[model samples]
Every structure is written in structure tokens, then in C-alpha cells.
Target chain A: AQSVTQLDSHVSVSEGTPVLLRCNYSSSYSPSLFWYVQHPNKGLQLLLKYTSAATLVKGINGFEAEFKKSETSFHLTKPSAHMSDAAEYFCVVSDRFSGYSTLTFGKGTMLLVSP
Target chain B: EPEVTQTPSHQVTQMGQEVILRCVPISNHLYFYWYRQILGQKVEFLVSFYNNEISEKSEIFDDQFSVERPDGSNFTLKIRSTKLEDSAMYFCASSGDYEQYFGPGTRLTVT
Candidate 1:
């Protein structure tokens, strides 16, 4: 079984400030992790993914995340926040050993970026 | 860029009526999935399909729900008898591996 936990339900930051959204996962086998963002009235969009290649993964819109096996974390970070960044973010996990078919999603974190 | 497409962006049906949602995944993708998000709630998986059969399904996908690849291109989800609680935003996704592409979504309202 694989599961993802998004530590915070909501995160608020001012424009130009650093942003962080924490996520932790548990899986029986090798895991594949992903970050998805959803804007108002829009479908979910992939931000970045960790397929056990590199620990640090860079994504679109100046966002990135680092996968830490020891800590069971895959925290998303951004150098600076933008008003357009306000949206819902989800952390997803899948079992690679199981052929990476099904995915389990976190409850999600609602980001509020203020200018 | 190739992307998933879903029909009936919004549908309104009476309680007990049946509804069918359609999706056309990326041309070459082999795996397809259906997920739903109730108003103000997290998205939940409903079912996944591949190779002309269902691969996995959640508890929410009971007898009332069914999926079919009826043709070479279109994938459809049929709800036998929808209730008020059935209202939600349905999203269709297709993936070959680690990353999946999603459709705009179908907003169903069971009144």
C-alpha cells in the first residue's frame, strides 16, 4: 500500500517570499512521487515528479522539490511566491515495484499567495 | 501538445436518471482512469482501465458505475442511477507511466 500525507492544509505567503509545502509518503516498495497544481476552474496540472532518479526535481513555474528517503519526505519549495501561485496543490505517490499504475493522492494544501 | 479531452463539460440530470461521461485520451496512451471531486472535497479515485479491461477500482465504484472502451478511441463511464450525492466534478486521465495527463473535466449536477 502507498499513501501520501500533506502536512499543512493551508499555507499563506507574501509575493517574493519563499514558499514551502510539506509532504511525506509511505510505500511498501520503491515509490514514484509527483506534485500537481490546480488553478481555479482548471484541471489538475503536473508540476514535477520524482521517479527515483534525482533527489531534487525541478518543475514548471519556478518550483522544485527534493525527495528524501530517510526522512520519508518530498517537500515542494519555491524561491519566491507569486499571486498567480495561489491554488490547490496535491502530493501523489505510486508503487514502482507494482509497475506504477495506480496513484494515491494527499488531502492537498491550499496555497494563498498575497501581494 | 496532445491532451485528454472530455465531453459534456457540464451536465444536469434529475435524480434516478442515468448519465454517461465520455473521454478521449491521448492518441497513443494505453492506460485510462476516472476520478471525481465532490464540492469542497479532495479528489477520489474511481477506476482505472487498460488493455480493454478494468485494472483497479475503488469502493465508490459500485454496481451503479461501469466503464467501457466501446470503441478504439472513446472511453465512457455510465452511472446506472444517479442520486443527489452523485453530483461532482469528474476528471479523466491517461498515462503511459509516471506522469498522467488529465482532461478539463465534466461537472455533473444531479438535481
Candidate 2:
């Protein structure tokens, strides 16, 4: 079984300030993690993924996430938040070892970037 | 840059009516999937298709929900009889490997 928990339901950050969205996972097998952002009425856009290749993964729009094995966490971060960064973010997990592509998604965190 | 495309950005239907959501995934991708997000809720996976058949499905993908690749380029999700609860945003996605690219989604409102 695989599941993901996004710790924050909502996060507020000022423009040009740092941003953090926390996520934790539980999986019986080796897991692949991903971060996706969804603008209002838009489709999900992949931010980055951790397929066990590197612990620190960088994605588009100045977004990045670090995977921690010991803590079972993959937290998304951005050096400086922009007004355009306001959106809903989801943390997803898939069991790569199981050979299936089905993904389990978290409830999501709504990021509010204010100027 | 290749991206998934979905038709009928929004649809309004009566209860018990049938609706078909259309999608054209990335040209070279083999895996296709359907997911839904109810208002103020999490995105839920409906089904995954590969090799012309269903690879996996979630509990929400009941008998009324079906998926098909009628042609080489088009993937579709059909609801035989939509209920009020079926009103949500339906997203179509496709992937060549592990990273799935999603479409804008179809908003189905069952009244």
C-alpha cells in the first residue's frame, strides 16, 4: 500500500519570501515521489520527481524538493515565492518496486502568495 | 513541447444522462489514465490503461465508468449514467514512462 500526507492544508507566504510545503509518505515497497502544482481550473503540472536517483530534485519555476529516506519526507521548497506561485500543490507517491504506475495523491496544500 | 489535450472544457448534463469526455494524449505516450477532483476534495484516480486494456482501477471506477481508446490518438472516458455526485473535474493524463502529463480537464456538472 502507498499513501501520502501533505502536512499543511494551507500556507501563506509573502512575495519574494521562502516557501515550504511538507509531505510524508508510507509505502511497503520502494517509492517514487512527485510534486505537482495546479492553477485554478488548470490541469496538474509536474514540478519534480524523486525516483531514487538524487535526494535533491529541482523542477521548473524555481521549485525544488528534497527526499529524506529516514524521515519518509519529500518537502517542496522555493527560494522566493512569487505571486504566480499561488496555487494548490499535491504530493504523490507510486510504488516503483511493484511495477505499476498507479499513483496515490495527498489532499494537497493551497499556497497563497501575497504581495 | 507535447501536452495532453481534453475536449469540452465544461459540460452540463441531467441526472441519469450519459457523457463522454475526450482526450488526446502526448503523441508517443503509451500509458493513459483518468482522475477526478470533486469540489474542495482530493484528486482521485479512476483508472489506468495500457496495451489497449485496463491495467488498474480504483473503487470509484464503478460499472458506470468506462475508458476506451477508440482510435490511435484519442482516449475517452464514458459515464453510462451520471449521478449528482459524479459532478467534478475529470482529468486525462498520459505518460511514456513515470511522469504523466495531464490535460486541462473537463468540468462535468450533473443536475
Candidate 3:
């Protein structure tokens, strides 16, 4: 079984400040972890993924995440939050061992960026 | 850049009515999937299709839910009888490898 949990349901940050969205996962096998962002009424956009390639992964829009094996966590971070960064972010986990590589998503954390 | 596309961006239907959501995935992708997000809830995987058949499906994809690739370019999801609880955003996705590209989604509102 593979699952992910986004620690924060809502995160508020001022523009130009750092942003952090925490996620933890449980998987019986090595898992592929991803972070996706969804703007209001828009489709999910992949922000980054960790497939055991690198501990720290960089994504578009100045977003990045570090996969911590010991902590069982993949936390998204952005050095500076922009107003356009306000959106709902989801943490997803998938492992090939699962029947069809099904992706399990977290409940999502809504980020609010204020100027 | 190639991206997935979905039709009927929003649909309003009566309970028990049938609805079809259309999608055109990235041209060369082989794997297709359907997912839904209820208001204020997590995105739930409904089904995954490959090689012209269902590879896997979730409990939510009951008998009423079906998927088809009627043509080379089109992938569709059909709801035989939509219920109020079926009202949600349906997303279509396709992937060549591990990274799936998602469509904008169709908002189905069953009244």
C-alpha cells in the first residue's frame, strides 16, 4: 500500500517570504513521490518528482522539494513566495509494486500568498 | 509542448442522466487515466487504461462508470447514471512513462 499525507491543510505566507509544504508517505516498496499544484479551476501541474534519483529536486516556478528517506518526508519549498504561487498543492505517491502504478494523493494544502 | 485536452469543460445534468466526458491525451502517450476531485476533497483515482483495456480501477469506478477509446485520438469516460455524489471535477490524464500530464478537467454538476 502507498499513501501520502500533507501535514498542512492551509498555509499562509507573505509575498517574498519562504514557503514550505510538508508531506509524509508510507509505502511498502520504494516509491515515486511528486508534488503537484492546482490553480483555481485549473488542472493539476506537476511541480517536481523524486524517483530515487536525487534527494533534492527542482521544479518549475522556482519550486523545489527534498526527499528525506529517514524522515519518510518530501517537503516542498520555495525561497520566495510570489502572489502567483497561491494555489492548492498535493502530495502524491506511487510504486510500481502496486497493481497498476496507481497514484495516491494527499488531501492537499491550500497556500495563500499575500502581499 | 504537448498537453492533454478535455471537452465539455462544464456540464450540468439531472440525476440518473447519462454523461460522457471526452479527452484527447498527448499524441504519443499510451497510458490513460481518469480521476475525480469532489469539492474540498482529495483527488481520487477512478481508472487506468492501457492496451485498449482497463488496467486497474478503484471502487469508486462502479458499474455505472465505463471508459473507452473510441478512436485513435479520443478517450472517453461515461457515466450510465450520474448521481448527486458524482458531481465533481473529472480529470483525464495520459503518460508515456511515469509522469502523467493532466487535462483541465470537466466539472460535472448533477442536480
Candidate 4:
């Protein structure tokens, strides 16, 4: 079994300020962690993923996340938040072995960016 | 970049009516999946399909729900009798080994 938990349900940040969304996961297998962002009425876009190669993974839109094995955490961070970054973010986990990996998702963190 | 595509972006149906949600996954991907998000809720996996059959399914994918890869390009989910509780945003996805690409979802409203 694999599960994920997003620490914050809502995160408010000023544009150009820093952003952080925390996630922790538990799995029976070596899991792959991912951050996905969904804009209003839009589909989920993969922000980044960690498959055990690099501890720190960079993604589009200046977003990045560091997978901390010691902490069982994969926290998303952006040095500067953009207005367009305001969206609902989901932390997802899956088994590393299969393309048929069943994704377990956390209740999302809604990011509100203000100017 | 290739992306998954879903049809009828939104659908409104009466309770007990049947509805079909359509998708065209990224070509050459061997795995397909369906997930749904209710309002203010977490995204939940429904089912995963591979090799023209169901590989795995969550409990939420009950008897009323079925999946089909009837042709080469189209994958579909059919609800034999939709209930008011079935209202959600249904997303279709296709994946290779490392990543899954999702479609823009079909908003299903059963009134």
C-alpha cells in the first residue's frame, strides 16, 4: 500500500516570494513521488517527479522538489511564486516497479498567489 | 509534446441515464487509467487498463462502471446507470514507464 499526505490544505503567498508545499508518504515498495498542478478547469500537469535517481528534481515553471528519504518527505519549492502558479497542487505516490503502478494521491494544497 | 485527449469536456445527464466518457491516449503507450475527483475531494483512481483488459481497479469502480479499449485509438468508460453521487471530473491518462500524461477531463454531472 502506498499513500501520500499534503501538510497544507491552503497556502497563501505574495508574488515573487518563496513557496513551499509539504508532502509525506508511506509505501510498501520503493515509491516514486510526484507533484502535479491543476489550474482552473484544466487537467493535471506534471510539475516534477522523483524516481530515486536525484534527490533534488527540477521541473517546469521554476518549480523543484527534494526527496528526503530520511524524513519520508517530498516537499515542493519555488524560489519565487508567480501569479500563474496559483493552483491546486497534488502530491502523488506510486510503486517504482511497474507502468501499471496505481497512484495514491493526497488531498491537494491550494496555492493562492497575491501581488 | 504528445498529450492525452478527452471528449465532450462537459456532460449533464439525468439520474439513471447512461453516459460514456471518451479518451484518446498518447500513441504507443501501453497503459491507460481513469481517475476522478469530486468537488473539494482528492483525486481517486478508478481503474487501469492494459492489453485490452483491466489490470486493476479500485472499489469505486463498481459493477455500473466499465472500461473498454474498443479500437486502436479510443479508450472509454461507461456508466450503465449514473447516480447523483457520480458527478465528478473524470480524467483519462496514458503512461509509459516513468510518467503518465493526463487529459483535460470530462466533467460529469448527474442530476
Candidate 5:
């Protein structure tokens, strides 16, 4: 079984400041990690993915995440937080070796940006 | 630049009524999936389809839920009888490879 846990429920940051959202996962097989963002009343948009190729992955809107196998973590980061960046972020995990391709999502971390 | 698209941005239905949420996934994609998120909850996978049939599904997708790709372009999710608890935002996603492209989602309000 695979599962994900978001470390923060809500994170508040000032505009132009750095931001971080942490996640951890547990899986029985090789795992694929992903980050998705959702605006108010909207569907999720894929931000980035880690499929064993690279530990550090960059995504759209100036967001990025690093997958650390030793730490069992995949934390999202951005150098500068924008007002438009305020949204709900989810950390998801799935196993490539498992027949069940469904994703297990973290509870989510709501980013709050202040100008 | 292609993305998944869903219809009826919002739908209001009575309890026990059937609801059909439609989607047109990115052309050339082989795998399709349906997911749902209740207010203030995590996104939950409902089903996954490939090769013109269901490849996998979550426990949440019970007898009341079914998916189909009846035509060449459109994919759909039909809830045989929606309950008030079924109200949520339903998203359709498709993947040609591993990265799934998601739709804007359809908000279903079961009253």
C-alpha cells in the first residue's frame, strides 16, 4: 500500500518571500511522486512529477520540488511567492509496480499569500 | 496545448436522480480516469480506464458509479443514483504516458 502525508495544513507567507510545503510518503514498491495545485472551486493542475529520473523537478509558475529518498520526502518550494500562488497544494504518490494505478493523495496544504 | 475538457461546469440534481458528467480528454491519450473531491477533503480516485475497459477502480466507485467511452471523442461518468453525500467536484483526467492531464471539473450538487 502507498500513502502520503502533508506536513502542514496551512502555510502563510509574504509576497516575494520563499515558501515551502513538506510531504512524506510510504510505499511498498517503487513510487512516483507528484504535486498538484488547485485554485478556489477549480480542478487540480499538475505541477511536477518525479519518476526516478531526477530528484529535483521544476514545474510551472515558478514552483519546484525535490524528492529525497533518504528522507522519504518530497517538499515543494518557490523562491518568491506571488499573490496568485495562493492555492491548495496536494502531494500524491503511486506505485509503478502495483497493478492498482490509483493515486494516494495527501490531505493537502493550503498556501496563503499576503501582499 | 491540448487539455482535458468537461461539460456542465455546474449541475444540480435531486437525490436518487441519475447524473452524467461528460469529458473530452486530450486527443491521442490512451488512459482515462475519474476523481472526486468533497469540500475540504483530499482528491480521491474513483476509476481508471484503458483499452476500452476499466483497468482499476477504488472502493468509492461502487455499484452506483459507472464510466464509458461511448463515442470516439467523449468519455463520461454516470451515477446511477446520486445521494446528497455524493455532491462534490468531479474531475476527468487522461494520460498518454505517466503525467495525467486534468479537466477543470464539474461541480455536482445533489439536493
Candidate 6:
């Protein structure tokens, strides 16, 4: 089974400051990790993915995450937090099944940005 | 840039009613999936469809739940008899390789 745990339920940061959201996972097979963001009443948008290729993956809107196998962690970070960046962020883990893969999502960390 | 789309953004129904949620995945994508997030809960996988049939399903996808690619462009998830617990934000996602793109979810509210 593949599962992810988000370390924080809510993270508050000032605009232009750094942002960090932590996640950890466990999987029986090789895993693919992803960070998805959802704005209020909006769809889940892909921020970045870690598929065993590169340890540090950059995504849209100036967000990035690093896959650390030794720590079993994939934490999202951004140099500057924007008010528009406030959203619910989910850390997801996917493991290949018979012919496909399924996403196991974390409870989610709600990022609150203050101007 | 193509993206997934879903219909009936918000649906309210009474218990035992049947609900069919529709989705149109990104064109050229080969894999489709359904997931749900109840209020204040984590997203849970429901089922995945590939090659015109179901590839895998989670335990949450009981007999009451079914998925279909009824037409060439439309993928759907149907709940035969929805319980109160079935109320959630249902998201449809499609993937060409591994990274899946999601659609605006359908809020299924069963009263």
C-alpha cells in the first residue's frame, strides 16, 4: 500500500516570505510523488512530480519539491509566497498496480498567505 | 494545453438516488480515474479505467459504484444507490503517462 502523511494541517506565512509544506510516504513498490494545489472551489492542479528521475523538481507558479529517499520525504517549498498561493496543498503517492496506478492522497495542508 | 472537464459542478440528491458524474478527459490520454474527498477528509481513490475497461478499483468502489467510458470522449462514474456517506467532491483525472491532470470536481451532496 502507498500512503502519504502531511506534517502540517495549516501553515501561515507572510507574502514574499518562504513557504514550506512537508510530506512523507511509504510504499511497497517504487513510488511516484506529487504535489497538487486546489484553490477555493477550483480543480486540483499539479504543482510538481517526482518519478525517480530527479531529486529536485520544479513546477508552475514558482513552486518546487524535493524527493528525499533517505528521509522518505517530499516537501514542497517556494522562495516567495504570494497571496494567490494560498490554497489547500495535497501530497499524493502513486504505486503501479496490475496495469495502472492509483493515487493515495494525504490529508492536505492548508497554506495561508498574509499580505 | 488540454485539460480535463467535468459537469454538474454541484449536485444535491436525497439518499438512495442514483447519480451519474460525467467527465471528458484530456484528449490523447489513455488512462482515467475517479477519486473523492469527503468534507474535511483526504482524497480517496475510487477506480481507474483503461483500455475501455476497469483497470483497478479500490475497496471504496463497492458493487453500488460503476464506471464506464460510454462514448469515445466521455467517461462517467455512476452511483447506483448513494448513501449519505457518498457525499463528497468527486474528481476525475486522466493521465497520458504518470502525471494525472484533474478536472473541477462535482460536489455530490446526498441528504
In order, the Cα lDDT scores of the candidates are 0.91, 0.93, 0.94, 0.94, 0.92, 0.93
Q: Give model 1 RMSD, 1 decimal.
A: 1.5
Evaluate every candidate with DockQ and list the scores. 0.52, 0.60, 0.58, 0.79, 0.50, 0.59
- Model 3 lDDT per residue over A21-52, tens place: 99999999998999999998788999998888
**Candidate 2 docking classification:** medium
Span of 10 residues, lowest total lDDT, candidate 6 chain A: A94-103
Top lDDT model: 4
Candidate 5 residue spans exceeding 4 A from truth: A97-100
What TM-score does the predicted chain A of each candidate obtain versus native chain A?
0.96, 0.96, 0.95, 0.97, 0.95, 0.95
Better of 4 and 6 by lDDT: 4
Error of 2 at A46 (Å): 0.5
What would the per-residue lDDT of candidate 2 be over residues A2-115, giving only the tens digit for each residue?
Answer: 899999999999999999999999999878999999999788999999898889999999999999999999999999999999999999998873334878899999999999
Question: How accurately is candidate 4 docked according to DockQ?
Answer: 0.79
Enumerate residue pairs that collide in model 1: none
**Which TM-score does chain B of candidate 6 obtain?**
0.98
Q: TM-score for all predictions?
A: 0.95, 0.97, 0.97, 0.98, 0.95, 0.96
Output the number of the TM-score-best candidate. Answer: 4
* lDDT tens digits, residue span B8-102, model 4: 99999999999999999999899999999998899999999999999999999999999999888999999999999999999999998768889
Fraction of true contacts retained by every candidate, in order, equals 0.34, 0.61, 0.64, 0.80, 0.57, 0.66
Q: Native contacts recovered by candidate 1, as a share?
A: 0.34
What would the DockQ be for model 1?
0.52
Which whole-number lDDT from 0 to 100 does residue B19 have in model 4?
99
DockQ leaderboard ranking = 4, 2, 6, 3, 1, 5
TM-score of chain B of each: 0.98, 0.99, 0.99, 0.98, 0.98, 0.98
5 or 6, which is superior by DockQ? 6
Better model by lDDT, 4 or 5? 4
Quote model 3's iRMS.
Answer: 2.9
